[model samples]
Structure formats: structure tokens, C-alpha cells
Target: MSYDPSGNAFDFHGSSYVALTPNLRKLGGEVEWDNATKSATVTLNGKTATVRMAEESVTVDGVQQPLSGPSLVKDDVLYVPASFFRDVFGQSI
Candidate 1:
């Protein structure tokens, strides 16, 4: 799923998924954002994963997880794969 700056949604990655709104909580188990570090933390099943905004990839328990699609940062907001939520948050779409 891909959402442009204009809020237009598309399945550019062929996942056929689209988020109606940017609801971090609904997409994951627990979501935390650190404004100072510009990073987001997602905890699932007692496992915590941290994603740095400026970084090209994210780390799960210190192991790098390659992203399948391009991450879009627009207006200071980062849009990543909803699968990331499922992987780290143990939630299903």
C-alpha cells in the first residue's frame, strides 16, 4: 500500500492494502514515538522493535529488517509498510 502526499491511496506494491487513516494504535499492539529521536517503537508479544526515521532500514532486536517497499516521508510524517505493523505488532489486516 502507498499513500501519496495528497492522501491518494494506491497498492503500488501489489499488496492490495490501503489504510483509511493513519491510526498507529489500530495497526499494531503498542506504538510509541520519540520526537527527540525521530523514531517509532512497536512492541508485540513482549518483543520490542525500534525504527529510526532517518535510517534506511529498521532493526528488530538489533537485527536489520529490510523493507520491501519504499518509505515515504511527507510533511514530517513517515509512511511505512502496514506489514511492519503485523510483523512487529502481531496484528493481522
Candidate 2:
């Protein structure tokens, strides 16, 4: 949130969490899961992002960074924090 000089405040809202596969598909990216590691590999434009469940971080092209929130798997589907799609895909999901 932010406020202008006139004391008018601005607020923005978006999903803090996002389901992986469908969201990635929107960006023309491919996602693959690994049951053993409880992680998913996201491929987009030759770049790979590894999203691990239960962790608050993602490894993109070998570089790991903290996520906006922790990730988790629900009903066998991987749900990631919105930050990954926003920051990595360079667009809103």
C-alpha cells in the first residue's frame, strides 16, 4: 500500500498463492514434478526454476532466492507462492 501527497492511499490485491501447472501454462512454460523430492521443475524460455514444497524459496537457473511465502502441495497438485510466477515469468498470473 502507498499514499500520495494528498493523503489518498492506494491498495492493490492479488492472489498470494497460485497453482503451478495451470499458471505456468499461461506463460507458455512447462512444469514437471518429482515425487521423491517433492519439487517441481519449471521451464520457460530455456530457463529452469525449481520449486520445492514446504520451502520458502525457488531455484531458478541454478540461482536460489527466497519466495514471498512458503510453498505446499495439495491433493497431489503443487501450489506455489505468486512471487515465482511474477518474478520469473515477468508477468502477473
Model 2 scores a C-alpha lDDT of 0.72
lDDT of each: 0.59, 0.72
Q: What range of 10 consecutive residues in model 1 has the weakest lDDT sum? A: 15-24
What TM-score number comes out for model 1? 0.59
**Runs of candidate 1 exceeding 4 Å displacement:** 1-24
The Cα RMSD in angstroms, rounded to one decimal, for candidate 1 relative to the true structure is 4.0
What would the per-residue lDDT of candidate 2 be over residues 1-93, giving only the tens digit for each residue?
Answer: 222233222222433566778878878989888889888998987889999888988998999888876775556566676667777767676
For model 1, residues 30-83, the per-residue Cα lDDT tens digits are 667788987777666677777776454677877887655644555656666656
Which 10 consecutive positions of candidate 2 have the poorest summed lDDT?
3-12
> In terms of lDDT, which candidate is strongest?
2
The C-alpha local distance difference test score for the whole of candidate 1 amounts to 0.59
Models, CA RMSD each: 4.0, 9.0
